[model samples]
Target: MRSDYKELDNEKIYLVTGAAGFIGFHLSKRLLDEGCHVIGIDNLNDYYDVNLKKARLEIINKYDKFKFFKIDLQDKEFLEEIFKEHKIDIVVNLAAQAGVRYSITNPDVYIQSNIVGFLNILEVCRHYKVEHLVYASSSSVYGMNEVMPFSVHHNVDHPISLYAATKKSNELMAHTYSHLYNLPTTGLRFFTVYGPWGRPDMALFLFTDAIMNDKPIKVFNHGKMKRDFTYIDDIVEGIVRLLNNPPKENKEWDKIKADPGTSSAPYKIYNIGNNKPVELMEYIQTIEKHLGKEAKKEYLPLQDGDVPMTYADVDDLIDDVGFKPDTSINEGISKFVEWYKEYYEV
Candidate 1:
């Protein structure tokens, strides 16, 4: 275990953008549970169900240490005011216009939220002198790569979707800030995260809802795809472990090799994944087993922006955080089914 996994001081405040989103909600709740003050910000956009976002906020609002703001990251003046009002020690940027397919028709939202919004965040972090800035990068950034287990060290210059491109751009932007302003930045490239309180658009939730309603579930790539389906709890655990352990200048970094994951400045990137890929068919089967109903399948060709597989190389994550996501598909799916049933009252 890392020695830095000590109790977080309540005096230190954390700013979590997209606090009502899937991962952000869980992360903010965890910090509040740890007796730390957390400033939560989210626009609660209609990209997903607004009620779902409100439901997540309802849970976090129970905690006295949690404060929420309904604001967009692109609004620099409002964001600046929030930073000036609160002494934020850490900033976790998780707000973004998510989804590969949506970006096809709604390209503008991605640029607005992922690009402009992120620039606003970088500026705020730079001005505020935040101890550490951890932002969400996606496995989608590993676009067009045939590698089995995607590593941060690999070149990710090719992206098939705008969403992926924006995420990659965030890394580049972060590196520039780190180099010029001496800000410590860490970007987490999360794999296919799923579990209780998951997004409605994700495979697990969609499969469960369709299967329960006797609707046909779209099986992309003819069910031959594979993904490192990480659980939300595990993803949150990795982020919490890294809250205090900011990146430092890698003295041994060489410009000759041009490694993509680390920099001479205080900038680093790591893939937070299960490190074990599961076939799409097998994953669906597990969900079916828990739901006690098989899904009506509509096998479809690979979507334009979709990849056939995604496998995360989390060796560096294990070495640095001393933890790995090991939740079995069976257990994780079962828990989701339980939550789905109770939440929807199915």
Candidate 2:
């Protein structure tokens, strides 16, 4: 644990929704390791794998200061019960139906989980008078923008996918609460996050699984894609830094030339991603180098809900948290491959 962890007020309790999910699990564990009290809630839906979610919970259950709840965000009554039971000072809302392609077919789940569920969270935070609310937003909200590096100041009104639209809606909703209730809110736009215990649907995990099984890996956009692949630890570190540093009212914010990233209200948004964008082929090559196996590639067209490239402008993150996600693709992939092999006994 870092000295800064000890400097934090351990009496402050954290409410982490989606606590069993990939990023959630890592973040909750980090907080627990730092001797912070954590109240974790997750429906543990089969969105990816219930067993994986359970395994994460099993680890978290080890911490004496951690409390687990198997609940859904949509169940506002149960969600509120937790807030009532625990004096949650800071709330991190990571629970959402995540996936671009899945949203194309099953749009209802996205609306229900991301929209309704997030609304519930905001309401609870408002009624409970939580100190700060930090929530997960997606880089996919950039939609069709062809900009090299996506910035928080860019216009994101045109979301290409339903999933992106829901994430955009969450930011809008959060801003409303911040404005109306004077709630302190911060939204993180995470890029391609990959590491050990990552979602099975994510690119790195899919590619690794396919290669390990001697199956063909689907190379989308004919291998012309680029992503700002961020490591999980970097993401956790960014969130931890922001936990104590809530957004303050930007007195200098101009209403005439309003910036979407900051507000006169106590609200802020930061792009938490690796500043470097990795080419799809190069990413695959790194994975291959680590696994010591060649992937059988099957070239395909760009998926409907995905952009050809995603590059994050993390200047705001560095300015705010004094940190930037600098984990290299080779190093991140190597760690993931090592964990994958050890976890599967391959």
Q: Which is the leading candidate under TM-score?
A: 1
lDDT of each: 0.93, 0.93
- For candidate 2, the lDDT comes to 0.93
**Given candidate 2, what's the lDDT at residue 185?**
98
TM-score: model 2 vs. ground truth:
0.97
Clashes of each: 0, 0
lDDT, candidate 1, 77-116, per-residue tens: 9999999999899999999999999999899999999999
lDDT of 2 by residue, 276-307 (tens): 98899999999999999999999999999999
Q: What is the TM-score of each candidate against the true structure?
A: 0.98, 0.97
